[model samples]
Target: MKKKSNKQVLEMLRNMAEGLGQTFAPFCEVVVHDLSNPKNAIYAIENSLSGREVGQSVTELGLARIQDPEFPAVIANYANTFPDGRKVKSTSIGVKDDSGEYVAALCLNVDLTLFQSFQAAISQFTKIDEKEVHEHIEAGGNHSDRIHARIDDFAAARATTSRSLKPADRKQLVQELKKAGLLEVRRGAEIAAAHMGVSRATVYSDAK
Candidate 1:
């Protein structure tokens, strides 16, 4: 099979991203990573939810995909978190040339925070006096509470308690948070570092 040129592959991926982003509306962010160019790997982005523009540097996972031949070809429905403490669900699909080398990747990130708030509103509006109600939105807009909840959610995805998370686990958690734009929030790194029981420098390094 003839290998597709990087330009062709990226163009296809860009179209797919734009179409998917439109179909999903505002909650989903679709990004195309050109692994051949790590410093400016975000070849295109649609429905930008993470404040990252095209030409932004590739993520740690992006670098991994470029450098590691054995990197997984697909990752689906992984836990992710935003800087302002919003949770996300994400999927990544590696795009390989006919030569069987990875040339690009398409990632979809779905912000679940808005959906949670919407669920809360509907629950309140349709509630009965005796029915049990579970509130997804925390009261008072407490940043600390939200941060803690995010940590716990990350830990839960790994089937472990936050206190029991290992160093490697914590690093992976940091990476996910970084990709979701959480580390960019004011004091976000500090809060995540404290919750993970690591130094602030360590948290930053984990993202690297």
Candidate 2:
């Protein structure tokens, strides 16, 4: 074994993760084993996860093993025919100690389902191909769609923009509104007068 530098070790781990992510493309892959039976597989890697997504359940992930079948046998040894019916591309390597005894099974989950979903969506769009689309839904919109989506996403209603903006943000928003000739109504008597529940004089007095 060669002595690896800290930077080299970190870079190696990063490259491994990146390669795994790419090779496991359209699916998630991870390595975790049962706490009770360290040699048995229990957890799967999920790459399709994002901001608020939680990991799936044993049943949801098809990790539940029947009395006759077990996890390590099901996923770790599965060469083909996953219950989900998708073609699984996976392999499991056992981690061992100095004694050469089985310690844990590293499991990898591939993301074929998400890729299929994206394919369906891209087919719906028809104008664009799946490869050009974002792997994440948040990245939706084609080159042409993005031109207007940018404008639509950034455009905000005055009432909402007014209520949320900070002092500086508010000032900037006001300037933008003024530039567009929308700052004609200040948030004082004029606003109250527009509501028609009170006169401009009462609204002015109420401001004090």
Candidate 1: tens digits of C-alpha lDDT, residues 90-208: 99999887767788999999999889999999999999787587554633235556667888998999898867788898888888888877777777888777777778998888889
Query: In candidate 2, how many Å is residue 131 off?
Result: 34
Estimate the TM-score of every prediction. Answer: 0.57, 0.28
Candidate 1's clash total is 1
lDDT, candidate 2, 1-208, per-residue tens: 2223323433443455457767755455554443223233343343633211223333222333322233443345353424656654555544333333333334564535666789989988887554765453322224224322322333354333323434454344334434443323434334423332335564344333
| Candidate 2, superposed: residue stretches over 4 Å from native | 1-19, 34-44, 48-78, 109-208
Where does candidate 1 clash, by residue pair? 83-182
Name the candidate that leads on TM-score.
Answer: 1
